[model samples]
Target: MTEIWQQSPDGRPLVIDPEGGYHAAFLPRTADAPRPLAAFEPFVTACLAALPEHQREPGARLGLELFLLGAARRFRHAEPLADEELLAGLADLFERHGIARGRLLDLLGELPALERAQATRQVLDEGAATVEEWLASHNQNLTVRVRERLPDWARDLEA
Candidate 1:
């Protein structure tokens, strides 16, 4: 059965199958317009690069879920979030997954520009600002600091 994921009114991520019943699962809502798989590649690569060698594979999977949750939240709002609000939501997500906020923030910083832009655009294309543009305009330097700390293993999605 094809399942459609969406955030419910209570802010829970839910899956609805073709029959229109909500399932007990947390699935990120798919974008209204499908994007290339490549749009997600950078997030996957960043997850892999951020995780320690012993937990790389599982970490990547969890990281993708966390990233998608953020995206879904953005899409639900149909607008850009204030930086503090975004970080707080992410912190809650990471806490639920037993990840430290600092570590998750570090990983987020490592995410490539292409992936960040794609995700931001996917949710806020109709808005005047892109994700990068918004960050730039606000002089948000946290993501930039993370970028500077990327390890050699971190791959660029654009490549």
Candidate 2:
């Protein structure tokens, strides 16, 4: 949720967190604007590098890389790559980094949507098991279209 996109001078997406909430050290300045596909590894490396020595192990690095990738996917502006090209590029990136392809693919599967819905469910409370139930009981307190996605936003909860 903290992630946001900024457009580079060349019009490619630049993912950032303005509040310095997530991995603040690596925020790109104007001079460092990256080419689209080339941006992923360098950003991940910088964020991982910012962590203390005790936390710089391979597994931790892989997890952070995946989490950042998910956030970037959620916020990055539209680009022209075809689906196959994008996936292939990602797969190559993972291969180069020693991360498993299956892990990358699994991370890509509706993870961001599920994460948002899960957060909303927590905000609504444990007893609120469905979107309809949540809305019906509390609809008056909020604005319209705030959660118009309905069932999708509450997908993590039981019906």
Candidate 3:
């Protein structure tokens, strides 16, 4: 169950471990391994592309995109990027997907970041003006479960 991943009938890799949870496998890396933000680009792109033209729940689709955005920023292991740079990157990503900066910020403002941060034990900044701020405040907790949820998100989009 642990040594090699078995292929399912649908050709998906499956493995079982004591935790009984899904996992994403990555090659082992040394302590100083470089994990650049670019590493998340393909997954983010594919996740977005998988979304149907007419979503049953547009809000959920937006949430999934937002999560992917935060994941892209959170996964980079080097020195933290500046807030301005991160904000610009976020804006660019959304804009590329046809979501305007103003619209995205409006959605961010509506999210209960403080409550979620408190619930998740992330750094609770009472006023997070943008998604980057919220994500930065919750980076640690956000990164911990990222890989596990990625395939789930893709499946959700396909569904």
Candidate 4:
């Protein structure tokens, strides 16, 4: 079957099959697309290069998610994102990996963080802590540690 290729608005590759079903395709960066973390491109490239060839696409996508999460938390004061926004970001990543949004939502609904985030929201609503404070407290765990270390690994790739 012949494949028709298009780029999603966020620059992910979309493949349209003869039957008109869409699939995600991991493709090389195009000139017109905005560079993600342009200042850290060298580091990102080196880190991706170190991954096994077959794993590169998924690894790169995960790295992007981590970078976004770290950046969002750092700049939360200037640009606050609701829980839905963070969840939407993960959904976008899953879509880029060829997972349907509905499936992604179903998967996320099963995660422990979903309940924790909701409970935290209730606490915040009760004025027990500000949104930022609640977020910072909850996000300080293993997942955030992993996300924060990703950039460090990327930087280390330059050594």
Q: Write candidate 4's Cα lDDT for 47-156 as tens digits.
A: 23433432344433333333333333343443455654444443444455444654444333343353244432332232222223434553333333334444443443
Best by lDDT: 3
Runs of candidate 3 with Cα error greater than 4 angstroms are 1-39, 53-56, 76-79, 113-159
- Write one digit per residue (lDDT tens) for candidate 2, span 5-82: 543223333343465443211222244643345644544333334334424344334334444464334323334565
Clash pairs, model 1 backbone: none
Q: After superposing candidate 1, which stretches have Cα over 4 Å from the reference?
A: 1-59, 62-73, 113-159
Instruction: Looking at model 3, report the run of 10 residues with the lowest lDDT sum.
Output: 119-128
Error of 3 at 14 (Å): 47
What is the per-residue lDDT of model 1 for residues 66-98, given as tens digits with 9 covering 90 to 100? 444444344335544554445454554444445
Best candidate, TM-score-wise?
3
TM-scores of the candidates are: 0.31, 0.37, 0.43, 0.25
C-alpha lDDT of residue 6 in model 3 = 43
> What lDDT would candidate 4 get against the real structure?
0.40
- What's the CA RMSD of model 2 in angstroms? 16.2
Point out the higher-scoring one by lDDT: 1 or 2: 2
Candidate 1, residue 37: lDDT: 28
Error of 2 at 25 (Å): 34
Local error of candidate 1 at residue 28 (angstroms) = 26
